[model samples]
Target: MTQAEGGLRARKKRETRAALAEAALRLALEKGPDNVTVEEIAEAADVSVRTFFNYFPHKEHAILGRNPEHIERALDRMREAPAEESPLTTMRFIVHDVLRDLEGEGELSRRGELIMASPHLLYQLMLSSFEDERQLTEALAERMGEPATSVRPALIVSASGAACRVAMERHKADPDRPIRELVDEGFQLLAEGIDPGFRVVPTKGHP
Candidate 1:
């Protein structure tokens, strides 16, 4: 096939995938996820069930609208980060940028609410979070010139994920506060090494 044909085909596939995901989320919000079916979502999106399955493995995935391509795009952005920046710093910037973009879209709260309302969806989201962490670990390893098997990369990625999760949870509690600000605060704590209740004793008579 010609390059133009391939490009057009890819764009059409993306449109179909997005339409299905949007339909799934809208239906779930309107009638609850437990009440929505793959057939219904496909019909709402004007696509066949077969096409929906091609984009999402199941109803939960469709409702969550988790796209693997998003991870690839994030990895690309991380790769473009300044060479002098530490991996954690690059990750912080990426997370902040991602949250800022989502804030603009105004769907984060609704998505969080939907996931929180569904136990099965929450479990699936946790599973996907682990996978994202693994992919991030590998990307950080490459960025830092370390072997993919290195423990440091995994530790960094896990810590970063934990920090971000905490930040998001706090944001959910008080959503009036800007999520990006909370994310920045979380990353700052991570940068500080998160010493557990450790306090330095002043040198005797030094002050």
Candidate 2:
């Protein structure tokens, strides 16, 4: 095939893969995740179930999606971040690069809300997290050129994850809020410092 024709073919494949993922997420939202089956998603996307399996190993894989290359790209950006930059700064730069294109995350965010609302979907997403965490940690370690068990990567990933989780919570509560602004708010909150007062309380009867 000519280079132009090959490029077009690759683009078409990407489009088809994206359509299948969108179909699966949509069905999961409309009828809850558990109700959506692989065959149903394939049919919705105008593809055979075999085609769906070619793109995704399972129904859950469609929901979680996969882009190891993208993660690697993000890590590459992180690696080149200023030497003196803190983890938060570096991670924000990396994550913003990944998320700024929108990457259809708004749709994913909506689907996430639906997933959270249903116990079944929540369970499914939870299962996906185990691998998600492993891969993320591995990426961080690779970027830092440190061992996976090192405290530096661990601390940085933890803080970054907390920021992301906070932003997602706010988005779920009020999606009208710009996600970037919400994420900024989380980082600001962390900057201002968190304090919890502690006191010993006496039993009312004893007092």
Local distance difference test values of all predictions, in order: 0.82, 0.70
Could you tell me how far off, in angstroms, the CA of residue 12 lies in candidate 1 after the best superposition? 1.9
Residues 52-72, candidate 2, lDDT per residue (tens digit)? 888888887676554444566
Best by lDDT: 1
For model 1, residues 1-207, the per-residue Cα lDDT tens digits are: 999999999999878877887888889999998999999999999988998889999999888877777778778877888898988887887676666655554566677678876888888988988998888888889988999999998988888777777766787788887667777787888788678688887898875
Off by over 4 Å in 1: 100-106, 196-207
RMSD of each: 5.5, 4.9
**Candidate 1 vs. true structure, TM-score:** 0.84
Q: Cα deviation in Å at residue 168, candidate 2?
A: 2.0
Clashing pairs in 1: none
Looking at candidate 2, the ten consecutive residues that score lowest on lDDT are 189-198
Task: Record all residue pairs in model 2 with backbone atoms less than 3 Å apart, i.e. clashing.
Answer: none
Off by over 4 Å in 2: 1-6, 101-106, 142-146, 191-207
What is residue 174's positional error in candidate 2, in angstroms?
Answer: 2.6
